[model samples]
Target: MKLTVLGCSGGIGGARSRTTSFLVDDDILLDCGTGVGDLELDALRAVDHVFVTHAHLDHIASIPLLIDSVGESRRFPLTVYGSPETLRILRSHIFNWLIWPDFTAIPNRHRPFLRLQPVKVGECVRLGERAITALPAHHTVPALGYCLDSGAGKLVYTGDTTYCKPLIAALNQTRNLRHLIVETAFPDEQHGLALASRHLSPSLLGAMLDELEVSPQVYISHLKPGVGERIMAQIACYAGRLRPRALVHGEILEF
Candidate 1:
């Protein structure tokens, strides 16, 4: 199985794109963002399931476009999975036939193109051969991270969280987690703002790592473009046993 980094930036700026990632071939997407536009039509068409992290606009804004882009060619329904709150935000705020036409009800009311599935925290949902469980995250809104057990080992994504206890505990308990894609959105100087907005700076990210019982290939995502270099520099100071590296758009990893 392969995981692709479509975009992993805190905020947009030069050389940075919004947050979106996917586990392709299996046709499961992690998040949808502007970077999704970079995917080819064939890839967009192959998406059958999307596991959203939160209701944040950046994490979900590209969903509608993605559905619409493949609406005509898709033969199967596209399932969007998220927490109840996240699904509600997408329904009432995004696909309410105002911001965008409700593709969930588009084409036909009975057999719509998209289906929204509410996945609660700690619940494990099976997708083909993979078992994915939603974990809680500390964000401005109700959010979740995910732990994907792909038979080989587990993979965890700390979707846009700050110093969260539940997520930290989950990570510590994850067995054989080969990859850890955590978000470090700002430099150490902006620690106050990062904490206030439920984002991680290098210092906080280090603390989160200290709580983990196992070490994995820690790849940092969702950086704030220009400050990515500085954030990583500071992270190097205290990231013991955690192989922290910045993720670039289009990077692919296989497990």
Candidate 2:
């Protein structure tokens, strides 16, 4: 499986600063953030499934637009997978016609442009030979991370979480874990804010890593736009033993 980082910044400022989104192979998306907008119309139409991590705007900002842009060209409805609570939030707030048209009911209910599927933690949804499993996440909103198993190896993405023991435990149990893409949203100076927001800072991330049994290649993501360097420097000072590197936009991981 080949996973490309569409965007990894916590917030947007310039062209390179795009919110979280990952393109999995060709037909799957990890999140539909602003980074998704960068895809061409044909590429947008090619997306058959999206596994959302949460309902935060940064993570789902382009979902509505994506459906609106490609619903007509697609032969089958686009499927979105998330936690029940996250799906509920999307139904209640996003696809409620007030904010955006409910594509699931558009044209006809039987064969609509979109579909929402709820997945629970530990549930693995298999598409072809690839298996994507929803993992536990502790964020401000109803959230989930994911484990992408290519059958050959596994790549884990800890989507916007703080210090979560269950997530660590789950990762520890994963066989052939090759890459770990975790979040460190703020610098240690903003540790209090990070805690309140249920996001990890450098110190917290270091602490979390100390409990890990598996040593996958660590890639840090979701760094706030301006303070990315400072946060990464702090990560170097605190979590340098793990040798975590910043996840960059357009970077691809093949396993």
Candidate 2, residue 63: CA error in Å?
A: 0.3
Total residue pair clashes for candidate 1: 0
User: For residues 155-250, what per-residue lDDT tens digits would candidate 2 score against the true structure?
Assistant: 999998999999989988998999999999989988999999999999999999898888899999999988999999998886345789999999
Instruction: Tell how far residue 173 is off in model 2, in angstroms.
Output: 0.4
Please write out the lDDT profile of model 1 over residues 110-204, one tens digit for every residue: 88899999999899998778898999899989999998887888888889899998888888888888998999988989999998899999989
Give per-residue lDDT, candidate 2, residue 169: 94
For model 1, the superposed segments whose C-alpha errors exceed 4 Å read 15-18
TM accuracy, model 2? 0.98
Best candidate, TM-score: 2
Structure candidate 2, residue pairs in collision: none
Candidate 2: where is the Cα deviation over 4 Å?
A: 239-241
